[model samples]
Target: MKILLNKFLPKWMVLIIDQLIMSWSFALSFFVVRQFEFAEILRGHFLIYIGLFCIVSLITFYSMRVHTGLIRYSSIHDIYRIFSAVLICSVAYAAFVALWLAPVHNIDSVNIYLVLLLNFFIASTLLIMVRLGAKALFLYIRSGTAGSKERVLIYGADGYSILLKQALEASNSGYFSIIGFLDDDPHKIDKDIHQKRVYHVNDIENLQRKFNIDKLFVFNEDLKSEFRKKSIEKCVELGIKVLTVPPTEQWMSGNLSMKQIKNLKIEDLLQRPPIVIENKQVASDLAGKRVLITGGAGSIGSEIVRQVLSYNPELVVICDQAESPLHELQLEIKELFPDANVAVCICDVTNFNRMYSLFKDFTPEVVYHAAAYKHVPMMESNPCEAILTNVLGTKNLADLSLTFDVEKFVMISTDKAVNPTNIMGTSKRIAEIYIQSLNNISGKKINGNNPAGVAEPQTKFITTRFGNVLGSNGSVIPRFRSQIEKGGPVTVTHPEITRYFMTIPEAVQLVLEAGTMGKGGEIFIFDMGEPVKIVDLATKMIKLAGLVPNVDINVVFTGLRPGEKLYEELLNEKELTIPTHHSKIKISKVRNYDYEDVVNDIEELLKLNKNKEELRVVKKMKQIVPEYISNNSRFEQLDMHMN
Candidate 1:
């Protein structure tokens, strides 16, 4: 009968169904209030009052949009809205009955008072319960066989767990049986959660073996590593998955799913306390300013452009040499903010005269130099080219910023610079040194000018150094996504390789904020969360695509490339990085190179450009960055012989 009603009845006709529900609710209220005994004349006269009650509640519910909401999604928010509307309707009914309906029906004063109060309570309760009944069915399916019901266990069985269980049970998405709960608190031992006794977490093995449980659901609001580690180890041993649903915000962001058992990430198992962002300074730094981004078409650069725009920069200059990308960046800028003055420039930072010309012409207030030969293998093949671009290009930009008097110069650097294992890292380390030295000398020159009464602009130079951005062009994420889409082999350099990662936007925002915190010469090392195993990354990518790893998609390990590290480092043995106002930002304390010494070294490196002595160039980089180590390179011979 319900199926037929739903099939033939238009949605507008559902209002009639709602009216019937209201009438039924009113009748049930009287039965509960009057102990199921009919007072004939009283019942006949009260029908008018009951009818009025149903009409008012129906109208109120509709107006409040409570009726229009999907009955199957009656979350606490939905219930709150329903109850609010019901309360308003009940109060109006009470007022109307007391003022007008009572005299018309000639209901005795005492009886009318009793009826109104009792009827309001019963009717309001029934209305909510009926919608909840629909919502409850949805929760049931979401938890159990109706969805992806791999037998699972819930830990803690706390209020959140109860909410989780209800949502799972009523969700038409699946069926979640009352798999008994587990709690460490002994006082709650043998306690029934909907008649299911609370079991010890140690009993997971027994349940996994018995029910063939496919997953373990951890429901602790906060995760303790010892407990989380034990749970994961047990699940791994049993070939069962351990999943966490996390906070409500994670659920709303689509990061956590109802099917995704609300709980913790692997990070939670090994999490340190979160770093606090210095909000006031971050907002004030770029709240209203003109910012220019070099390589703005590239990953980190483009992201910088996006983030700075969010802080409402007066203007953002996106400069890149690549034709296709710059065009796309312009379009993206147009689509995102049609009114934003995002100018596209087709100039390379390596061209000193051109860069200086642009700085002078555009009068850019700040510049973020992100352009460089980033790919390690490619840079290894073209050593001289990498040196020119990474080292000399940085020189051009910094010198130009100093000349044109730009507000700040932010050079985006990499974690590979920490204990350099590749030419790319070595080159970046060289660039950092060159940029830092220039900033120091520039400060001296500016200070010297003060005594001569010569005016100079404050060009604060800052370098934001971090490891890797996840989905930037040519990043691992895009490569893995493409490979998985092609229906096969996901490539990894080595089975043991790992690197630190942060979302592009998150990294970019920190980069911009770090740039503004510079006090002349400082390399702000970003606090990258933690390094993730490449193999595990590949596996997750495969599974997220709903494909089995070995059976469906192959993950092939193809030996490490030239200059690549099995694991990237963020700090050096002899280095010290002091914290800023933000725990996530650190300032490296390093020895300063003399201006004459720096100038001489740069000249020596440039002379080697024609010498075909690749080792000499790498050695020169070592002189600049003492921590530089040439991993798997012929340049190691140069250092050995020099010693």
Candidate 2:
């Protein structure tokens, strides 16, 4: 029986079996017509009638190719074929007997027609049922041999969910056994679909207690729906792992594969609704315009590059100091946009000569300055490099934008720059001050000499500030994920530390929107919804990975690193935001400086950084921005001296 269930019968054997079933149906028809008097029915032309019916059935069944369907994977289409073949065979054979055979053999047409009618019904039922029965039997045997199947419940009771279930069952992988469906619809509660019960969301706990469901399959769209979102949260809270069904568009060759079903990640749960942008405005602004991205190889910068490319830019100059990452970004652009006009340059933003050559060559109308030393601790230890890059690099780019007449200079800033407590934040705060001061004095004389020696600046310097970006390089989310994967302690800086999280793409979208809207001298802060606790984020990530926090994976509190904030603030105590046209973006009413004074101070600061006098450089940085105070660092003593 195992072997028979394992291997399918050949086509010829299937044909013979179908023919025998049809013959039996015909015999049963005779018995019914003769009122169970089998001897009477067999008396005169019974042998000839049976032989003639078999011949007709063979011709029709073979012509219709009824035996071609695999019994173990039969579908509604196969059943339809079986029904059509049987119906056609009955009609054709009965018509032939009534028109020619009945008259030629002096047969009673009424009696033969009745038998044919009964035979039609019996044959269709048996044929369809035989295939269905075989499929059930095969699945049962396969499940037993494949070991204990995982009991799962699908999340939605819609047609798409049923189709997904059918696809999963049809696949040769006999590991999952679908118990029922879970839904939030009140109307669908406790209903039966395909013999499986439709369960309500409120009953999830009871269902889990009763059946111990291994997983719940949810459609990708349901993850975005509000009601479904709550249901998914409940399931997660119950420790029932949820698997996401990819969109139908991602299905391979119009069929869902087992590999395409993925475990739900914490990102999915944390991501908010999609942001609506002014696509036409951004497209018009960027179309055919030359654009420059300073950190084009980094996460936010690369995404900006991609989004800019989609706007049909005339040329994109990708400037980054990282060699391999720049090359990889170039390759990715080539592969994704074969006809894209992009130039990749390996040049430090702090180098005026190299950057000057780039600006002269590309003559970009728009520049997005993203290059900076962003790691808090690293910058805390190395203040010289931080000032050089974050301050001087930004200065170099702003100066060149003026010399080159760039239309927009969007500088990516951080929330850490708001009343900064570390060297990294202070340096960024200095950069923001320089750009805003420069914007205040645009198209006018400044103290610094440009390469072109042009006095009037045409560039609009705009600053965008936001908190931590999820999944970016050196971000906490990826670090936690890596630790979890290594099966050990996941180190979070503090238990109560909280930071606002935004997806990389979401942040970049706002950047582009903010860039397009800026006239000049505006510090645009994005509305990063609610702050997420670091400890809670860590715990949820461990749960998402199917591990218990402090049990399977130890989540250790390593205390706050140098210059780390227990909470990040988007605005300083002295600053307030004015409403912009965009709801998520607002302009900061920040203090501005005189361009001449800032230029002189920055020049001296640059000299100190050039001599690698880290202390003097940091001291000058603090003097320029008095709000810059060191927290839990070696430089804290400097802050004390100044105070």
The whole-model lDDT of each prediction reads 0.72, 0.89
lDDT of 2 by residue, 363-396 (tens): 9999999998899999888888898899989999
Highest lDDT, which number?
A: 2
- The regions of model 1 sitting more than 4 angstroms off are 1-150, 153-158, 178-190, 194-207, 215-274, 310-313, 322-342, 444-460, 481-488, 502-517, 526-533, 536-554, 571-586, 603-643
For model 1, where is the 10-residue window of minimal lDDT? 1-10
What does the lDDT read for residue 506 in candidate 2?
Answer: 96
- After superposition, the stretches of candidate 2 with alpha carbons farther than 4 Å from their true spots are 1-70, 83-126, 139-147, 169-174, 249-255, 453-455
> What is the overall TM-score of model 1 with all chains considered together?
0.71
Over 1-643, each residue of candidate 1 has an lDDT whose tens digit, in order, gives 2232133234455455666766676676666656677876464666676778777877777787765656665566766875687668767777887788767766655555566566566656766787777656544444344334546666676776775665555443334565777676778777888766787777777877787775566654545446655665555556556567666555553223566663333334434333445556766777767777888889888877877777777778788999998898888888998888777889888787777667766777778889988998889888998988888888778777776677788899998888887889888888887777777766445322232232465677787788877677788878888898999799998989998887676677677668767877888888777678988878766655556787799999998887789999777767798988777889988778676678679879977865867767777777767766666666667667656
TM-score of each: 0.71, 0.87
Question: How much lDDT does candidate 1 score?
Answer: 0.72
Worst 10 residues of 2 by lDDT: 247-256
